[model samples]
Target: MGARRMAKGIGEFLMELVGEAVAEVILGLLACALLLSLGLIAYLSWSFSPRLTVAGAGGLSLFLAYGAWGAFRNPSKDRRRRGVAAVATGGFTLAAATAVFLFFYGSDCGCL
Candidate 1:
């Protein structure tokens, strides 16, 4: 009976960890999708002024950076896993920032 209880406890812990991981993945994807949609809108909207575009992009980037930092700063028993999450979050943040910048400023470049 004691061994069976121990097994059940371990199963529960594993399930909880899986749930947390799934939640994190979903949140990350949602963030990326939102940023992508914003970039598309900014790119396609001719009436939106450059100043407003820059301000909106900067604000969004700052907000996302803060959120990503907060979400990934927690101590985890699996350091490697945490490191991967941090890297993924940082990459997504960078991508979002770059998309916003390009949408607003890429036209200024002569190469385009």
Candidate 2:
């Protein structure tokens, strides 16, 4: 009976650890994707046109602002994780918005 109890406790601990690890891994992937998309958008906009450059920058700035707000709004628990998630969410939104804009507004430079 004691061994069974120990085994159960260990299993619960391992499950909790796995959950946290999974969350961190997901957040990390989001950060990476955000950075990569931002870089790509900047590069494409640099040579495309002033209109696109302005639009992309504006959209990204808005996302950043929203992320900052979210991070500050909930400062009691998991502050670091919340901040990371906010930034990742903002970046993903910006990237998606930029993609949609590019898709419908099709650049004339043929670089897209």
Residue 67, model 2: Cα distance from true site in angstroms: 13
TM-score of candidate 1 against the unseen true structure: 0.43
Q: Model 2 clash pairs?
A: none
The Cα error of candidate 2 at residue 28, in Å, is 0.2
lDDT of each residue in 1-112, candidate 2, tens digit only: 9999999999999999999999766655555565567678777878789787898779767776666566456566554545666665677666567566544433332332
The C-alpha local distance difference test score for the whole of candidate 1 amounts to: 0.67
The runs of at least 3 residues in candidate 1 whose Cα sits more than 4 Å from the true structure, single-residue gaps closed, are: 47-112
What are the models' TM-scores?
Answer: 0.43, 0.46
Counted clashes in each candidate structure? 0, 0
**Residue-wise lDDT of candidate 1 within 27-47, one digit each (tens)?**
555556665676679886535
Model 2: how far residue 11 lies from native, Å:
0.7
The ten-residue window of minimal lDDT in model 2 covers 103-112
